[model samples]
Target chain A: MSRLDDALREALRREEPPEGFAGRVMARIEARKERAGAWDGLMAAWRGPRLRWAGALAGAVLLIGTAAYQETQRAEGEQAKRQVMLALRITGAKLDLARARIQRVGYGLGDR
Target chain B: MRIAIVVLAATLGTAWAQDIKMPPAFDKLAAKAEESVDVTLDSGMLQLGGKFLSDKDADEAKAKKLIGGLKGIYVRSFEFAKEGEYSAADVDALRSQLQPPVWSRVVGVTSKKGGEITEVYFKTSNGAQIGGLVVIDAEPKELTVVSISGAISPEDLADLGGQFGIPKVELPKSKGKEAK
Candidate 1:
């Protein structure tokens, strides 16, 4: 029984801790906090200017694409307008010539 | 079978009455010409071009109004470096397509001295109304064929003769400048 009591005393006895144990624990906690802070900064950087740059790039591409389409349409429309004008000019010229000849014939003028 | 035949006949008859096909000889002439102007504008292209024509300009406005109901306009003008590059047979091929029963020669002017022949043919639709017009202007060194298909009136023809850069042709006052 006494042996048992002595073993209990030895097991439950309060003893002084080794030197710098609390400092080591505090240092470990500080290192963990620094690592967490650095990770948060990296995430914040990704969310800030990097996301904005991606959005801006997408918007620029859309704007350029729309402008190019409008330019193509304008060019084609202008070409068609030119063709129509040229056709009208040729038709008008020929018709005028025919009318002139008809008038000359009506006036008893021979084909000169 | 009878109904199908009737439908096909009607469609073909309508097409034949409205459009004049330029002969393949014109393509050969185009290849040989020094300078050629070939303009073919269908209904869709005309509509697109008409949208761009400004309402403010006088000529553009007139042109836009003129082409409002037009189905197509095809013009082929070829100018050779010299005379005799094209033969009379080429012109005959075009004239053959504009025969009677659907087409009638409205005006024909031939100048032997200047070696110029101009003929205008009108295609009739519904017996009286003009459905299309074709103009063949064959000069010594130039050949121009203008075919406009649509509902065109005599007033429209007069407008074409008067405006759109067609100088009001005045009778020669004792051979002054030969009417340009």
Candidate 2:
């Protein structure tokens, strides 16, 4: 009976905590709550439409920039095509001159 | 059906234009040239340019037809401030790129009076279709190279003559059979 009582007392006795253990625990709890609050705030801000709107604006700007670049490239290509036609015309005229001259002399130009 | 045909033709045209190889050295001469013109048009640009051609003008209509199957047109012309700015070696370098079986020199016209030399070449494939054309004209102070890729006929080109500053090329009359 005494042994059972002793065991009960031992089990029920309050033990002394290590020094500053409660301070560490309290600090940890406070720090965790602060971190959680900050995270919560960030999540709320992200969930708002401002970030999404910003994202959409950025995408639109990028698309406009790409379209502008393509337009410039196409313009340059068109200019190049015109220049090509002109050059070919000049080339054809020159070849015609040579051929006409050769024909007038009756010395036929060589063929393939 | 017509749309499909046009799409197919455009696809084939683009495919044909990719075979040309130009010497990198030509850029150096272009810089030194007093007057220079450089043009490179791929299939896409050709089709786009075709839209602007006048339907009423016979010359434009003929050019549109001539360029129907053409994949690409590349031309480079350089007029120098003085003679001898270009070298024979540069010309030789360009000439070496053209070889037999795939390419054949069709015509050589030399005029001593103006100190001009012109050589025309046709690209042959399968003995049925001419795939490309080249013209190299060298003068005392000017040099020009024209390369057209894809299936273009001599007559189609001749159709574009007498207009657009293309002095009408009187092709030698066909006798017996045909020269081309």
User: How would you class the docking of model 1?
Assistant: acceptable
Please report the candidate that would top lDDT against the real structure. Answer: 1
Candidate 1 clash pair list:
none
User: Which residue pairs come into collision in candidate 2?
Assistant: none
lDDT of 1 by residue, B1-180 (tens): 999999988866865755788889899999999999999999999998998998999778888988987899999999999999999999998898887767878778888999899898988778454788999999999999999988786666667765776675654445333554
- Model 1, range A2-104, lDDT digits (tens) per residue? 9999999999999878999899999999999999899889989998999999899899999999999988989889999999888988898887777677675
**What is the C-alpha RMSD, rounded to one decimal, of candidate 1?**
7.4
- By TM-score, the best candidate is 1
Runs in model 2 deviating more than 4 A are: A1-81, A108-112, B1-18, B112-114, B169-180
Q: In candidate 1 chain B, where is summed lDDT lowest over 10 consecutive residues?
A: B171-180
TM-score per candidate, in order?
Answer: 0.75, 0.62
Runs with alpha carbons beyond 4 Å of true place in candidate 1? A1-40, A107-112, B1-18, B127-129, B170-180
Task: Report the C-alpha displacement of residue B109, candidate 2, in angstroms.
Answer: 2.1
Deviation (Å) of B116 in candidate 1: 2.0
